[model samples]
Target: MTRSATLDVLIVGGGIAGLGLAGYLARQGCEPTVVEQATEWRSSGYGIGLWSDGLAVLDELDCLGAVRQRAADPNRIEIRATGGERLRQTTIPPDRTLLLAVHRADLHAALRTAVPADWIRMGTTPARIRERRGGVDVTFDDGRTETFDLVVGADGIHSTVREQCFTEWTLRDLDTYVWSLWVEEDVDVGGDMVSVWGPGSEGFVARVGDRVGVNLAARLESAPEPPALDELRTLADAVDWQRPALLEETDEEPFFDRVREVTCERWRTDRVALVGDAAHALHPIAGMGASLALQDARVLAQELATTRPERVSTALDRFEARRRKPVEREKRKARVEAAVTFVESEPLRRLRNGVVEHTPILDLFVRQQAISG
Candidate 1:
């Protein structure tokens, strides 16, 4: 049954960012209702890396055990030159388990499984929201209205809330577009995870349970593929698959994703606030998009946990202040990483690889990740 017209929180978006913050808030003595644009909850997207920082959030939510059981460590990462000239291997050591590569759906399922179904109403979306002295009034697509003490915008890169609150800031296009698909193969991929090389192309594949999940994307100027999975699969196949030619002779219905980095100037407006990808979507090449989302949820919840119900926005402001720096730092890292990408020269690649392998730079980079960890 629905509670009173007023609630402590109304979360917009049912993706990981939304559901996670909702779950975390619910555990923090706040009743949160989640509104998802999707008709029903389903995990039908490409895979993502669940790094240690995000896993720390899952650990708090008590949902980590479920995700851990269904995921693989994929601790071994193999990087090979396009001509097979040099190979570099990196491993997550016994003392430090850096991340677990997981499908987006599985991560979503694990997070949702812990939240009460009644708290989340699928197919509910906000048409408009008004903030007054008492609270915020939220209007839904079904012509219904509800008031809440606070609203959390976890809607993603194209957040409608951001449009409403702080639309003045421009989300600059990074001159690069990304796409991915999940493929299955009977044979092992030689390494647990492989980042293959090609001229102006790069891709990675890891064993997601029994099936193999692959994600590939290159710089595209125009509409590279139709905004659908089947069409994007064609684009996925168009890229250079330098990963030992496993999919060259297979017919599979693979999951696909078209990616773009989301940047924004404003994250909080009055009583309603943005978190996770809604606040900022970083470039996917950094492999930290999912990590950032999870971190946003975790930090936002921590800030709210200690504040009174009436002071939620103040907590959100705190969340914005603490998050902006670390997130911007990662964005800068992604820009540098994406600018060079896999297209540069062999000498350049060797120079970059050698720096990562033989110098303290890589260790410092790892320590930066440890900041969030």
Candidate 2:
């Protein structure tokens, strides 16, 4: 097999992972094309927490400074019981990097600006894929077929690329749902961030730039979907916290989704590979979703930077190996945090809170998640 001067890469999904990878690959002189199912460029969530590792990747793509300008750095977190009893307040050490909080739309815009407009195809979906030596042939829903040295599935949990290529894999429901909103009024959160944990539910408020981001996660008894905002309020009302102000300010619709996890035996097959939520959708409790996706893009870009099209398969394998351990560890942390925050048993909830209050364990764990990839 001969090496090409530039490899053509097809990226599925226009979310954080895809767009971020497109920018990184373009910087390496690879011809990257992104196909988004949505007709226009948009972001789904309200605000995202960018950890140090995620910010570093954005820095590599030259998009961090702009994003930083539009974001708020939160340095402290206040943990409280559902009844507003203060459990513990952890102030991030001065030497540690503060988590940058920004509206998802702003972050998306920053990434989009870095990627060339021509490379992204809006209102498009990959209908079919045929992998051959040194490349893969992809057919779009619009009836166009193209061959690329590499095909990346950066789509989220229900990814088409993953479904078609790794048919054996599936998303595991965590039996929880998350609903979040970004309100114009800044809800009076005591610290940089506040997380209230109660029986069966957890609520978080973060001051992101000029807006307040409120998130509510609940463990459902049955598999029925989470209720709408009005019903959600009733459910959340079971716990006591500063929800009235947050709810009053929440004029725009809330973003709702089920909490699911994806574990793949392999992240790649042939010249095709998965990234971001497509590869491993961890619980959002650890706040590593964006960071992990950004890290995935960075690591994949690094591996692909020095490889030829003929050796792309090996490069992808190396990318998977280098990333898999860290991702799995992150997934484990997310699971543990989810269990602690959403504990329904009153006794278990109190025990967890007592541990958090009496020991430095929870803070250390949070710091570990925040700093490491």
Candidate 3:
């Protein structure tokens, strides 16, 4: 088959992982084309807790200030029980200089704005998957074929690239599902994030922007029946700490959902590899997927920039090895919480919630800064 324009690298998916890789590669002077299945990217999802690790990657890529200006709220978080009983409270990391509670759309918009429009090809996906002489050749849905020195699947879970590149393997599913909702803040719920544990489920709620309060619910095992908006309202109403003032102002609620950390057996192959959710889609309950994904993107970039192009496969293996440990540990932590929060034992559930309510470490868990090259 005849090949089209050559690329130093072809990155799939235009989400944070894909854009982050393209941005860093562009800075390194490598030609990269980011292909997204979606015609237009949207940041309408919930807010992500961008920790120092992810921030450091953004810093190196020269977009940290925009992130800070748009996302960082004053560092403070609270842990509580069903009512307003304060379990634990702390000023978020003082040394990190800043922490963020930015909305999903704002961050996406910021990243998209920084990338050259030509480097991003929206509404495109890889087609006619086959390994070739230099690397891989892909014909797109548009009937365009292109070759690259390297192919990175940043497309996310259910990645077609992953299915085509690797032998069949199991993606172990963790018995948890996450539901997130955004509502206008009615009252001040403090500057800190709030995480609450209940029987058979856990909740994380925080005010990120001027009027947005994001709530996340993670339930263990098989997912429950279909839920409606009122369930979250009921759950939010259940929290009386802020009471009338808080409930009065909250309006225009929207809900989004996902499965928890469903682990895959591996992350790379010759001339091809996975990054971000495509490779290591961790539990959002950990609030670390974005940060971790940014770290993975930077790691892939550092390896590519520093290593010879022919060593791409080796670099991918090393990247996977470097990230697998941290990802596993965090996954295990989330699993433990899932077990406690979703257990049939009522007393055990209460105690777990009790500790989160009182535990100062709630705000200290995810570290998001990038490693220097």
Top model by lDDT, which number? 2
TM of each candidate vs. truth: 0.87, 0.95, 0.85
Write model 2 residue lDDT over 1-373, tens digit each, in one string: 2123377889999899999999888877776889999997665575677888998989888898889888867678889998789899888776666588787888999999889999888999999999987578888898999998899999999999999889767689877888888777846778888889867888888887787888888887665543466657865677668776678766677888788999888899879999999999988888889999999999989888878778888889899999999998888888887877888888888899999899987578666866685
Clashes of 1: 2
TM-score of 1: 0.87
Cα-based lDDT for every prediction: 0.71, 0.84, 0.68
Backbone Cα, N, C clashes tallied per candidate: 2, 0, 14
The full ranking of all candidates by lDDT, starting with the best, is: 2, 1, 3
TM-score, ranked from best to worst = 2, 1, 3
Which digits, one per residue and each the tens of the lDDT, describe model 1 over residues 189-299? 667877665445567778877777776655555554544444344444544343335455345544544556676776886688888877778777777887788788888
lDDT of 3: 0.68
The numbered model that scores best in TM-score is: 2
Better of 1 and 3 by lDDT: 1
Q: After superposition, which runs of candidate 3 have C-alpha atoms over 4 Å from their true positions?
A: 1-7, 93-95, 172-175, 184-186, 220-227, 237-253, 341-344, 353-373
Question: Considering summed lDDT, which 10 consecutive residues are worst modelled in model 2?
Answer: 1-10
